[model samples]
Target: MIKSVNCTSFKIERLQTDNGAEFKNTFLSTFLEGCGNIHETSIPYEHHQNGNIEWMDCSISEISQTMLIASCLPKELWPYAFCHAAWIFNRTMHGNDTIAPYEVIAKNKPSLLLLCVFGSKGYLYDHLFQKDLSEKAIFGYHLGEAPHSKGWLFWIPDRKKVLKGASVKFDKNCFIQRIPASTSSLSLIQASSIFDGSMILAIEKQDKLVSSVNVSHDPIHVTPINYREALASAEANEWNIAIEEELTSIN
Candidate 1:
């Protein structure tokens, strides 16, 4: 974290932490000494001394709650929702002005075009684990934007992990909306058809570049899409990048 801070325009001065052994270890002390930073330890059991972090935690927790209820996604995904909320908050306006926190921190204007709806389902290519294009990419739910990336974060259920990549194929036609599984068996059939992208061509007026799949309900929130549809939406270059990430991962 300090290394990242140093890479930015700001020079290290002081860092404060609660009484945690990880922050007080010999290796950490040596590193802090090398960086010429002053380390301040907060009083034991006095969390109020860290009001800034406490407030930040509370704020993120509230945001997480709102998103979980609004999206009807599982509560286990609170961490992902919190991360997404913070990403949106950092890039978008905070005060009565257009300037954002990201701009202030990075000294550059943050682009809004990269933003996606929170808890929305999106697909990512599976070039790495999958042997060939015959299978195409994997599907996932949008967690938030990838840090230091034009890409987005997604929860990969099979691995039980979150992955960030530029290859996220987002299609609005996808079902992040409410669809109770017990309502109808036809809904399940409909879900399968949507995953196969049969409904996209039949329903929508215009041809979407990609037709997002309907495996939408998960603890992690995911939607898969067809590969052919992805090729058109992702464009050649971005698609290539996705393929490359897979290849690299496999190698």
Candidate 2:
């Protein structure tokens, strides 16, 4: 909370939250007291006290769900979808605002040139892992912009990991699909269909990106649930960089 507060340009005189143990802790109280900020709590189960945040949460949830349904990606990837939805929501103009909320907070305009559809077909070029005469690129689904670097973020179903890459190509015509079986392969189906209010031409590519095709039907891992998990992850370096970038952006 202190780190987040320090990033903001404005001074916080008072902070209000629910009567959760996370907020009513000694550690948080000590920090807030040292900062000379007042801490207040609303009655338990009284969600309307935080009306603005509640509305924002509902909006984000709806947007994320719609994105997942359109992409046909599993609900396990909802975190990425939620992040993408929030990113879009922050950049959009709301109410009587002339500029976006991001512009107001960051003091700069957000660019939409690199924005692509969620779960779009992506190809990550593998320079180190590819063998001679082997396929140079592997298929994945586009998640969003990389939080750490200027590259794009992708979810490779085959590797069961999230990665960031600069040399990534996206085929917006194709969408990701999950296979139920253990083995997975990409296939282009020939069909004329309407998807997400847009007319798709004949021979639409339905690339089956294998997420977690276990014989036991286990759940697929999406992302780290906490900082410790992120630090212990295979993409620990990337996550660390992302944490730094997030702090930098709020400042």
Candidate of highest lDDT = 2
Q: Which residues of candidate 1, in runs, are more than 4 Å off?
A: 92-98, 125-139, 156-168, 178-251
Clashes of each: 3, 0
RMSD of 2: 17.3
| Model 2, global lDDT | 0.67
Worst 10 residues of 2 by lDDT: 202-211
- Which residue segments of model 2 deviate by more than 4 Å? 1-8, 175-251
CA-lDDT, candidates in order: 0.62, 0.67
Candidate 1: C-alpha RMSD after superposition: 21.6
Candidate 1, 46-127: lDDT as tens digits: 6678877766666666777788777665455655677778876677775486688788778899778877877687788765
lDDT of 2 by residue, 91-170 (tens): 99888889998888778999887688888888998866877789888888888777646777777767656677889878
**TM-score of each candidate structure, all chains considered together:** 0.56, 0.66
What is the Cα-based TM-score of model 2?
0.66
